[model samples]
Target: MLSRRLISIAGAFSLALTITACGTTTRQQVGIGTGAVLGGVAGSAVTNGSTLGTVGGAAVGGVIGNEVAKKKK
Candidate 1:
């Protein structure tokens, strides 16, 4: 039961990201989106579909992605 819920949450998260990623055209945007998807999936799996976990994971992942995409001067 819990596994099913987690799967659903991950699926929904992935779908949402896919829809949103369609118009992205920058490395930062791609990074953020990819991070969000991976984070959300990992978060959901780790937390058993916890809303906070998924959101927090996405936030953290986005920050990480942004940093990774930063250009060195």
Candidate 2:
């Protein structure tokens, strides 16, 4: 159970990173939008359908994505 939980957490982090990386070529606005949507879904799934987790994840993902996009430009 512990291992599974750890794996899940790691997977979520990796997915967030991958999404942010993919948006790096685009503008910050686009990145933030896409990241928020994707992150929301991922967060919901990871958190077992928690609304707060989804929202929080979306916000964080948006920021990270925007930063990445800005850096790439």
Candidate 3:
């Protein structure tokens, strides 16, 4: 349980770092990455550490984030 929580936290932190580092790039990429990270974390948490759920969440999140970023212009 604790380990899972740690992993989730690490994932979130890693995502934050990734997004921040890429902030200067295209907003679409940043949004997609952010979404993927957030979705992965949520999916992992909800699915009790299922890899499939995490990946699926990331994919969906990435798409949504990408669309949103593109619209922000």
Question: Which digits, one per residue and each the tens of the lDDT, describe model 3 over residues 2-73?
Answer: 587567647765875777785476777778888888888877878887767777777788888888888633
lDDT of 1 by residue, 1-73 (tens): 5876566566657765775667756777777767777777677667777877777777777778778877778
Ranking by TM-score: 3, 1, 2
Tell me which residue pairs clash in candidate 3.
none
> Which scores better on TM-score, 1 or 2?
1
Model 3: lowest-lDDT 10 consecutive positions: 4-13
How far in Å is the alpha carbon of 60 misplaced in model 2? 1.0
lDDT of each: 0.71, 0.66, 0.76
- Report the alpha-carbon TM-score of model 1 versus the true structure: 0.69
Residue 11, candidate 2: C-alpha displacement in angstroms: 23
TM per candidate comes to 0.69, 0.59, 0.70
- For every candidate structure, what is the RMSD over all alpha carbons to the true structure, in angstroms? 2.8, 7.0, 2.6
Sorting all predicted structures by lDDT, with the top scorer first, yields 3, 1, 2
lDDT for predicted candidate 3 compared with the true structure:
0.76
Better of 1 and 3 by TM-score: 3
In terms of TM-score, which candidate is strongest? 3
Give me the displacement of residue 47 in model 3, in angstroms: 0.6
